[model samples]
Target: MQLSFETDVEAFRAEFAAFLDEHLPRGAESLERPRSTAHIPEWARRWQRLLFDEGWLLPGNPPEFGGRDASLLQQYVHLEELARRRIYHSFNPQGLGIIAASLLSFGTEEQKHRWAVPVLRAEKTAALGMSEPGAGSDLASLRTRAVLEGDRFRVNGQKVWTSGAHDADFILTFVRTDPDAPKHKGISVLIIPTDTPGVTRRPFGSLIGPADLDFNEVFFENAEVPAENLVGELNQGWTVANGSLGHERTLLWLGFAERLEDLTQDFRPDGVLGRDRYATLVMDLQALRLMGSAALARAARGEQDVAALSVLKLFGSEAVQSATEAALETAGPDALAHPARTAPFNPMTLEDFYAGWFERYARSFSGTIAGGASEIQRTIIAERVLGLPRG
Candidate 1:
């Protein structure tokens, strides 16, 4: 299949590049590595605001909801350009991208009008409340309970690995409404404002890099939200959650390709490695990119086999690990010893951030585990895509 963009997309790319050139933060190189989940720097916020104003931030949303009604391919181009510029929109990624999309798809019209605009405009950030201490990949087994009260649902549970919970205005959460129902059938999605009476957020330091990227654990005790906050049909949240995961996997795969390219270029022999090793790394990097692109194209075309995404996740995670390992080899003993240096078009302080990179390596292993483990992906491919019998 031809992966090349048509002329209109080429023009979109040019326009996006110009926007990045004009608005990328001045003196961003000298800025300290980001350290908190606070709003992005004013310069970066201005850029996001520009996109919001220009109706580009949520290009997939319809014009009535402040988007251009752009094609999925066009949306892909926008993301590629943004990632190429290494522009991290720290404001409300979860809100604008994942949660907003979920809400738009499954939320009531009132919920959509109430939540989507603020989310897309970065007026509010959102956290995902899915994983619990014991439940993650086996999401249907989650134990968070939302008991129905007269006019509200009283929620009580702890959600772990919730990114930006401490800073977010709300959480688009998954909770079990009927414990006796089959594993996947009793769950429900809810919108819980962070400032509710029984809600508490505690910050945790990063397992990966700076504290800014810290994921959190949130506790909700008798947190009462209006029954109207329920998203989609009650007792059917598993479907919505799965849909969100599918969207997330697609975005992650695309972002990973961009990051892999950035890392490969930064670690080139003249830049950071020896010639021979760099050549090998380049070839591996190209393969990873092609595999990811192919998977993304399939997804853009509306393929529902989660295994395709899982394959990209598995390959992308491994590719990142391999690239980092190669970089460590290229750095030799000095890898841990060199002062941290910031790369122009990558997450800041990547070189001397050995601790961070190592943390990422550990986390990449979890990428397969988090959304669905690699083994699970293989199972999905076997049963769903390949039509193999389940054991």
Candidate 2:
């Protein structure tokens, strides 16, 4: 768990810190507030470009792809700097961090130049199309179909809980390309243009903060994409998914752990966080950090433990939920009020990040739900990490 960066990383941090001071726009500091779904204000996109121009987007990619092909420590320092400044890592974090990572790992050379570069440049955004209305935890049951026809594939079905679908330029869609084969074997991933004909997205209603249009149910009615858009080998999507999933889970869990620590800082149990509970939550945050660091260390050595991600995912999410619960209990009567109003009344609140504490608290549950559910993660732990027999 030693995060001691190489000498080059130390220099990189000092340089990045200076850049943040000079380039960060006013009022944009510390936007990593919990349950805050606010994204892509024109200002943010402009800021994203500033980072892009400075070669700060992806340190692991080749220089041509807005990266420096930096060392492992340099990459770690890159993310740490962003978190320290509380800046959004990208205009499209999913695109830059998750989907782009996958494309870099599994995509053809042409795909990387065509898709990943635009994503890093912030000229386009991408959303992962994996979960379905009926096949969430049971992804093998997903029924979305994409039949190959000459140089194109005709896609049909629906994707639910699709984040940024309405705004993304395209989707890295997983569809059934061989129904006659086993469910898992039949699946394939495609890069489908969001604007393709017969593709439609409708926003879902929300009690959470920010725009409702960020999360949508996307329907593909015989949507079509060039056959060359296929990502990875056909029927090999399940393997392709692991590349992005592992990288994202590593970074995301670290973020959640860090945010939980930030939220509960200066926590007095006699106040919003009960004394014993606050102590325990703080310790849990520490444990989550160590786990995250361990995962990062492993990744630095080029060893990704699927089981470790499951453990981090489960624990990291549950830790947030616990912190949120403590915050709510600490707020007492004020917790029932709207987040905007509660901010003014709660003496414990110091930063604007707490303005929507309640909503953020409520939204904490999505951590366990999204990516993969707690139950599913536990199963991964049992079957893969621990070598336990399934029921």
Q: What is the C-alpha lDDT of each candidate?
A: 0.73, 0.77
Clashing residue pairs, backbone N/CA/C < 3 A, model 1: none
Model 2 per-residue lDDT tens digits across residues 1-391: 3457667779988888898788876643433332212145555566667777777777776777777778776877878777766666575767887887888888999999899877877767888888898988788899999999999999999999788887788898989999999877888999998889999987676666445456778999989899999999989887887666766766677677767767666465565677888888878888987887788788888995778888988998988887878778778777766655533332112234345557668778888887779999999899998889989
Candidate 2, residue 347: how far the Cα is off, in Å = 23
Q: Residue-pair clashes per candidate, as listed?
A: 0, 4
Relative to the unseen true structure, what is the C-alpha lDDT of residue 331 in candidate 2, on a scale of 0 to 100?
Answer: 80
Q: In model 1, where do residues sit more than 4 Å from their true spots?
A: 1-3, 28-43, 209-213, 269-277, 296-305, 329-333, 337-370, 385-388
Once model 2 is optimally superposed onto the true structure by TM-score, how far is the C-alpha of residue 214 displaced, in angstroms? 1.9
Alpha-carbon deviation at 309 in model 1, angstroms: 2.1
- Candidate 2 has a TM-score of 0.89
